[model samples]
Target: MSDWMVTQTPLPRRRPRALSPLREHLRDTFWFAPTAAMVGVFVVWLVAQELDAALVRSLRDDGDFDTLADLLRFADDAKTVVSAVGSAMMTFIGVVFSISLVAVQMASGQFTPRVVRLFVRSRITKATFAVFLATFVLTLLVLTSYDSGADPLVVASAPLVQSVLTLVMVALSLLLFVMYVNTTLRLMRVSHVIARIAAESFRVAALMPLPAQDGQAPALGPVTAWVAHEGQAGVLRDVHIARLVRVARKHGVVLRTVPRTGDFLVPGTPVLAVHGGQAPPRRALRYALSVGVERTFHQDLAFGLRQLSDIALRALSSAVNDPTTAVQALDRVVQILATLSRRPLDAVVHRDRRGTVRLVQPVPGWTELVDLGFTEIRACAARTPQVTRRMLAGLDDLLLLAPPDRREPLLRHRALLRQAVERSAPSPADRAFGLQPDRQGIG
Candidate 1:
């Protein structure tokens, strides 16, 4: 029998209520920024009111009537501007975001749904929403503080600090608007979107750098117990690896994860298998794995590969029939593959300070990643001479970087590509042209 087996027995259902998971959830949300901005703006309004009162008192005590008069005139002039901005801000937010969302939708439809997450998690998107709402709120607060019937000093206090703050907010909102427009337009372009995804994937690769080769894990005792996932079906987004290692060390057991970061989990799915001594509490082990509705690039290194593949596949589809986009995606795919070539792709083993193996987390190795990046594109691009040529070039480039052990997958893909071109291309000339490796496809 296999080392790990799926059993029908159900593990205890324990919902993950950890703060780390909660932080991760909020980090990806669109509403969190705006909500936090609202709370922050209210506090700023109170501070602005106090500062306005203090400025009025100081100016009155110093008998600086001329400067005070100038300030009031400036405030009056700014009132018209601020009021206009206040009223238009919300509508501006709606229109800008609506158009931006439409662009995002079109890009997603053109590329892949995974690209939406990149836009959502963008700092510019969150900053744009936060600044727009804050400007509108601050403007309303400043305008409502005015009173014509009140004394000159009372009215003077209203427009001092608050008016300045509102004006600054308006300026920030305008700047963010320009930036948002530029970003949205760039997002509409396929090259920018593909580059963004590849850049993010590169960052992930840097963070989770693999060793040159897999190190042998210390031997442990036999299997003792199994822990299964008992919750609504979801993707395994991330894991608290440190906590798992600690728990295993304390319990004197070895825990091996059955599914990888991007795998989907349903109830009764074997999540972890215990080896050696006593197993840790099922609750701790279950909570260590953060499962969510969808996969995130947070800990799932292969998510970028998945996204690029999706874009390439969509471009090659009959509905789109855009081979250039596929070639562009293939460009990034090869770049990522080249980077992964120098690193070891193997199961990650975590050990305690005493050199005892505590946890084993399986990940996609070289062959799997190679197949993932090439197989679909090769099959889909066989009929398209440009894409096939680009793919062949990509595979050859990867072959130079990949070590001896890693070259097998690259060689296999190259042969497969030649076979596909021979079958898809009618004439010998066409087959020969398709097999010729060109980094820029036809170019």
Candidate 2:
């Protein structure tokens, strides 16, 4: 089935050179620029001092001719020692600066607050500091034997120090790289959580049985067996029925049960036949609602906002033919979108005057329609500001497909939905439901 299909799209390539110049400059300057500048300055000063010393020695030209050769050899040896020390110091500084810069950026407001809290509470910071300090102390010990008098110690310790420092640097680098990857994964997981919640909310709002004032049961149209198992006759307990009853009560549904034990039932055979109600509550809705009120509210709000946003955009496009007006509508649209930005979207069932029930857009099953609506809105926003006849047709199609029972609730909540739609269209990060440029013309 189409519902089970997973369409994989290639990820967008990274465009490092295409990034804004200012952003690129900031990234380069934050960690590397300072260290590079300091190192360059130090090297230039050292080189100038060495050149002056050599010039003075040449000018003196003492009677002891071997003095020049000894001074030359001493200078060469001193350069080697200084180079080694400088290299180690530069490596250490680079590592420290990189870590600090990355950590600070991660702590910034770019990610969810939960992610920031998780990273801040991590013990890796302390562990990293300890590793750095140990590396520093070991490097200092190795450099201590650089005196000429300790020739044997310097010769033996030099290679050992180099080897140890190299290994330490490699290990530290790997550790930092791993930490960065872990932080990225954590942020991704947090984003997924929000997306999943938003998706599920929309699904619930589109699929759940509509609320009714009259306690009438809905007819069981086609009961697809989601799960089937034969158990003991006593398995059908009062508790199970009570739970179903509670769900019915919440949705203003009435249930009548004719007790049957271990009876063979077909797909369309209603276990406890319902009547005078909207759609029957599915297991998913029950589970979602069971979580808690806050979650339910979040889910419902998100779904509602998404639906309203799509509807409003479609309506606005059909009404206005001008691009400027369409974009202007977005400003009004933003108000409705805001209410749903942080909330979850859920299904809300409604029955029509014709006594037929159908699911609406902004729900999981109506993904295709929602996508179409999103495309229409984006097109209108980009190309025309005025609503058009075509946009109205799209809105009409959406309204026509919605369950008839929802008319009253919708009319009653028209203002609410309008406000939400105006406020809740997709933002930059929440563009999963937005139109894709490539797919725009196709739809």
Candidate 3:
């Protein structure tokens, strides 16, 4: 979800802030949410302490000795319960997350390392850790307030509210634990993981505006200057597109990013090619491009396709020859390519108010995306009749939806699939079956 780009300003005249690389980093990590939760639990513990003291004072003053005695016993019982829950909670946290990490690791091995991002981004996993740790902390604070004085009345400054609150926290932690288990289990399933990847891809696609039917924009004069990257080497994750557009308009220049999103960058790599005029300040242009250790779906449109293909490739590998799983991955790939067939996937062109091109952000075109999605799978699945048949069907379906201009890649891939099958299949029967389009591969 952190991949959700910052919403761009509707009116170009208003300047929008650049996307913060730190925000993306935090969203990809696991620490911030649990740390905040513990702080919140500490505050709640303070409030419960005050409320418990207040209730004790009110009861003692009313000379309700009998009720106070019962309250004292209840507080003692609650303390024991809270202590047990608190001590057990840390072990529970360790066990749950340990199992979760193993599950995530196994999945990464079975599918692709990219899928580890899906597990890391899970909100349920974070919430479970937060609440479970918060409960443990709450119990520790509540137990510290318990007095061992022989004077019953004095000791009756009972942690009544704190005890009750701790019990409620314990209950909530149990509930989240159940939900976390369910979510973790779902993450392990191939079908579920494939569906999640597809869903995220579709979500990113939805954010892209349909291409303009017709438009003419001012052309760039020529390359005026080039801006080299001056940061830690990493993947070019996302660009602050709105901010680049604003900077370009302000300087009366055309700014073109040299590297597309998802490209690996070392320091001094040409990141931006300024056109029409000299480059903007290096700092100004630097922050507009967000570089990170790995790629994300937020700005890299091809990443989803890449991930799907990776899954299929892994499935078809000799180490794990599961053509059925490869077929399933193709199912989603077909859907994604079909959706893309209708949309304009040319380089994302940004224009100024006067309809002059200001920023040209390069992205994968239809041909490149189609090739990225199919080429590797086609080669790897060359002899697997199930995957070959399914791929043929998927390409056929895409051909029907593809515009005339976009059909070339599909037709080329179809031809390649047949050649691959013919070369790899052991006999004439297998070759014929492999070439035949089967929506379900074999069934």
Best by lDDT: 3
**Residue-wise C-alpha lDDT for candidate 3, range 363-403, written one tens digit per residue:** 78888889989999998988888888889999989988887
Instruction: State the number of backbone clashes in model 1.
Output: 0
Angstrom error at residue 39, model 1: 1.2
- lDDT of model 3 at residue 301? 83
Native-to-model Cα distance after best TM-score fit, residue 122 in candidate 2, in Å? 4.1
Q: Pull out the clashing pairs in model 3.
A: none
Q: Stretches of candidate 3 above 4 Å error?
A: 1-22, 60-66, 150-157, 210-218, 350-358
- What value does the lDDT take at residue 282 in candidate 3? 71
Rank the models by lDDT, top first: 3, 1, 2
Where does model 2 exceed 4 Å of error? 1-107, 112-115, 122-126, 145-175, 178-443
TM-score of each: 0.89, 0.24, 0.89
Tens digit of per-residue lDDT, candidate 1, span 225-314 = 888888778999887877898999888788988898989998898888899866677776667888888898776778888889999999
lDDT of each: 0.81, 0.36, 0.83
Model 3 Cα shift for residue 376 (angstroms): 0.8
Model 2 agreement with the true structure over 80-148: per-residue lDDT tens digits: 554465466547646655765565465333322222323332345433444444444434443443344
- Residue 104 CA displacement from its true place in model 2, Å: 3.5
